[model samples]
Target: MLAIPAVPDVPDVPDGARPRWSVMIPVHDCAGYLALALPEVLAQLGDRDDAEVVVVDDASTDDPGAVVARLGQGRVQYRPNPGHLGAIGTFNRCLTLAQGELVHLLHGDDTVLPGFYPATEAALADPAAVAAVCRVRDVDADGGPLHTTRSYRHGTGVWCDALESLALSNRVRAPGVVVRRSAYEAVGGFRTDLPHAADWDMWTRLAAHGPVVFVDEVLACYRRHAASDTSTRVRSGANVRERVTVVGVVLGYLPPARRAPLARRAYAYAAVFAARTALQQVRAGRLPGAARQLREALRCLALIPRGLPRPP
Candidate 1:
């Protein structure tokens, strides 16, 4: 086996001086993007003494440390993993190391817009809310706009019926949300078994405990690139399998009476997504991959009850 590279050292924070907000960027070998992402994040923090930024490098071969060191300007903290930790492990580590009342686990390549902090902080102001999410703009690799998303209806200062909305789909992206640290501790960090839909799973768990607030405006950018883990997982069909498994896990969080209806809707949605994936595979002339996706789609469809109406 090849040898693993050692991580760079990070400065230790003094005990009992936790910040109000901890922006944790978990990165793996995407230094170029990190160079772009960190500046915006720091600018958003804007001399706030009550907030700290941390970059958790997950044993990437590339020089993410140097990128953070340069753009971070000594404001951002760096914590490189001692060994190779997968996405879930890296995320759990970020939660563990973060010392804040609220934590935002921003991806290395994604960025938050100007109003992200203020908007999300306001949404989480309600003591009953455990988390807050805002709309996101999906951008290309070079930070050009692709499309914006509004998973929930447009309305400022709205508290979503999170459990009801999240049961249908993963409405919130990881980069577009801020979670309370205490809520995270209550539910535990991201599940190790869920490689693809862990964020969705985490959201569902959080919503079950307390209300989740929504900010109407676009507050973050989700970078879409060929090299992204999402793209790779979608192509490999791991995304399909893991998403199906996630729906099952999330259903268990619901009351017994509500589980069947949600499960039916969830499986139907998965089937439709898989069917679309199969079509895309066919368009690319990958007949074998298309066949595999078709099979998965059929399996999902079969899981749904026979007489249930299809999701709109």
Candidate 2:
């Protein structure tokens, strides 16, 4: 088994020194994007003492530290991991290092739009909700617009049925959501096991604790490039298997009475989507990959009738 590297010493927060918000950017080798993203993030902070920005460099071979020093200009607190910690490990490290009422785990490649802070903060003002999410706009590697995903319901309010919506699909992009630190500590950090679905898993678990507020406007941009972890996994067909596993995990977190019906709905949806992907693969002349995906689609369809779910 591959082991995750140990986290080095993170700067300690003085006793009773808590900020209103901690915007944590975890970067591996996305310095180009970081240069663009940092300015936007810092703009949102606007020299506010109650907000802090922390950038975690996971021992990248690239000069992310130099980038931070140059663009961040002594404003962003920079921490470099002693060794390599993968995305999940780095996320856990961010949770450990964050000392704020709310934590925004923004990736180095993603950017938040103006009004993200005020809108999300207002939504989370409800004491009953543990987290808040806004709509996400998908952008290309060059920051050109691709498409926008309206992950939440069509209004600006707290959604009590967040788990049900999340069970269907992950509506919260990492950059678009801000979670209360207390809720993160209670549910634990992102699961290392579900690499592709870690964010989805975290959303489902957090939703279980309390309601989730949704902002109707697009508040963040998610970059889809070839080098991104999601793209790499999808190309290798790992995401297909991980998607099945994520659905099962979400099912386990739901009430037992609601599990069976939701499983049927979820697997049925997966089967249809997989079949479409298989057809696309075949059209692209990847015969073996298409056959494998066809088999997965059939397997998902078979499970729908039995109402029996299994983890990958």
Candidate 3:
């Protein structure tokens, strides 16, 4: 098996008293956005005794706790890291802090749309599923809608035998997924190796554990800003490099017969995606970023012939 860092076991809690859901908001210097995200979650959890929300600050310069206090009004708990622990570490920290049957690590800057929790919960009613994901809406810095990701199917249901389809690409976003706490314990916490595409890795692992429920409707907003981790990596072409690593990692979980062809398909898709992003950057007048992305695109094209390594 590939060695991913293990997520520390959740602290023992009495089974009967535990909350049904844990919405852990992991924040770092996103107080302004947290102000917007917290309310949407709070509205849905209104008067619900079984759900808990908490904001885990990653030693941000800004005060996300203040936002939690002002808006959460004791409804959302706040915890600060002793020191800066970047996004990945903060996510694990949130995992450790969570005390619910189902955990949703909501990015501090993202929000779940109305009916998101209800719809996903309904879909997850089947006891065999380990996770439930709704469609994500990409939004700009000011919360303006950009576009929604494509639906995996016509409606909400368990994605039966979805491993091969998911291994080729990461189609879900963090804000859209709510995983079982035990599943996090089973696979491991997020790692630093694939910063820009970590969610892809986690989602694939969840798919492997068992069934993954999907709600085709757009039920969450994923914010994209110039300074976000993804945009920063895109500018340096690191995102494409990470995509290559992620594709390699995800393929290891598949059957040997399926690896090679899927590798080609994935590499081809990555190249095309990089090229498209490069073109978008060029139109946006980010010439330097465009150049870096173009270089990564060429690298992806080169990977088509020599397939990525599979697990031994």
Candidate 4:
């Protein structure tokens, strides 16, 4: 079994000297897209050798490992995992390998916009700021604009706004943001349990610890392809159920004083999601899935008329 060195809690080098940004890409059979993505990432670096790009290949069936290796750029380092552990594991592994003060969890298939590095660096310059999230545009496989954008406000405090945001919707998409390594570790990073929404989970935790600077400018183009996990979830029509699961877990993490209101809101969102899921399944002629969603929606709706309660 191949074992790469664990990501150190703190790089041997001091923060005063470590790279300003650590661009981390977690890959699984994304070779076809990496070639297009890597150069764009490099271009965004803007002559900053203090930034490093660590690409962790998660045992891809395609030769992505070799592709990343051939990039031959000293700023970019490549590592292959022992086996396939899916996206969450790949993300965590890449986090472990990062050496910079900031780690941007850029997916292998996503392309960084022209101003990504500069915008992110400016956000992290403030000592109190723990993260910087830029606008993200959803693009088709051919890189055409899909007219969908993930946008949010400059949130106050650490992970608090993140928690509240997830309670609302997945506003801070993974590729849309960059994280301070110290703050990221303070929150203990991504939750392996929520594989489908791990990025949302991490963002919630991250936002609780410090302030997240919202770059109003679009700094990334997130590819919406069938092969991508995001699209797969949408196509499977499991988005509603997956979101419900995420909300439940996030509600559990809130304080007792906030849980009740949050839970009520989460349930309401779940009801809407359930109804949507039921509709999608019915349209697809999947009676079993539709029936299951109908039950879930009914259960949520039944709780609504009872009035929203304060947190326990």
For lDDT, the strongest prediction is: 3
lDDT of 4 by residue, 149-232 (tens): 544554322333555766555676678788888876777756766778777767766666677777777878888776777545
Every model's TM-score:
0.88, 0.89, 0.95, 0.82
Query: Over the stretch 192-306, how does candidate 3's per-residue lDDT look in tens digits?
Result: 6665677788889889888998888999999999988788888999888888888888898888888898999999989998999999899999999999999999999998987
lDDT of each: 0.80, 0.82, 0.86, 0.72
For model 2 the local lDDT of residue 101 reads 85
The number of clashing residue pairs in each candidate reads: 0, 0, 0, 12
> What tens digits encode model 1's per-residue C-alpha lDDT throughout 176-240?
98989888877777877676787888898888988888788888999988788876766677777
Candidate 1 matches the true fold with a TM-score of 0.88
Q: lDDT for model 1, on a 0 to 1 scale?
A: 0.80
Please report how far candidate 2 places residue 29 from its true position, in Å: 0.7
How many clashes show up in model 1? 0
List, residue by residue over 1-312, the lDDT tens digit for candidate 2: 212223333356686677889999999999888888898877878488888899999988788888888888577999998799888888989988888888999999999999999899999887678998899999988889977976456789987689987886676688999998888877877888776788988898888888888889998999988788875554456656777788888877888898888888888877876777678668768677677777788878887886755764
Two-way TM-score contest, 1 vs 3, winner: 3
By summed lDDT, the worst window of 10 consecutive residues in model 1 runs over: 1-10
Off by over 4 Å in 2: 1-16, 275-295
Flag the better candidate by lDDT, 1 or 4. 1
